[model samples]
Target: MAHNEKLALLIVLPSLLAGCTSAQMNMLTGKRNKTYNDVNAPWVGSTEEQLISKWGPPKKSYTLESGAKIISYEDMWGPISAYHVCVEKFMIEKGIVTKWGISNCPTRIKGSLPKDTPIPQPTL
Candidate 1:
């Protein structure tokens, strides 16, 4: 790599890790909020049953001809005006989780959304 590129990376990497992430920090837990990567990394070699036990039932589960199964978990919370959705998929081979990924999850970076919208929060 060029000297300029290395300097640029050195300057940019810290800022990105400091706050550019979409993940929030949990007040109660004092831990970084769970992102798909953070939550699923440990489950890479875990069994399907073990995953299910921790995460409860998946939203959907199906198998491919290759004998690898995929388990998906989706969660959307908050009101219609401001909600978040993420569908996390895990690949299970021989009943053990081998790989996992998010098919289509949309997230607003911090400060991307307006704090004070003209529309008020609706009460049910």
Candidate 2:
């Protein structure tokens, strides 16, 4: 191969492999999106009261400039080794949940990933 081609491959190969896709991340975190989505999909139209009833009062709540409300709940029972405590945030408009996001929330894996394990970040 030409020198420039080899250099390009060397740069692109690691870049492509370094970042984990959402699916891969879910697997590593022990969550299957299909099952999780099946269960959670209905929540999109649910009332805020229903959510508060099921989850109890959120750890944090706020209102946005657009008059939408946001509530956040944390799950401390998640896998403790590699992931941080799971945080769920929901956006409520007119008392209904419109959207949500979750981070670092994974089911309890039997073991933890090693601390300080090196992961290559993309060079951009």
Task: Give per-model CA RMSD.
Answer: 15.1, 13.5
Best by TM-score: 1
Q: Please, what are the lDDT tens digits per residue for candidate 2 over residues 1-124?
A: 9999999999998787669765566566765334222334456789999999998999999999999988888867535585467677788899998887766655333333333333222110
Query: Each candidate's lDDT (Cα)?
Result: 0.67, 0.67
Model 1: lDDT of residue 73: 94
Residue-wise lDDT of candidate 1 within 8-112, one digit each (tens)? 999998786677434342332243333345455668889999999999999999989999998889978667898767778888999999887763454232232
Candidate 1 lowest-lDDT run of ten:
115-124
Clash counts per candidate, in order, are 0, 0
Q: Estimate each model's TM-score.
A: 0.55, 0.52
Candidate 2: stretches off by over 4 Å: 1-38, 78-83, 107-124
List where candidate 1 sits over 4 angstroms from the true fold.
1-34, 103-124
Pairs of colliding residues, candidate 2? none
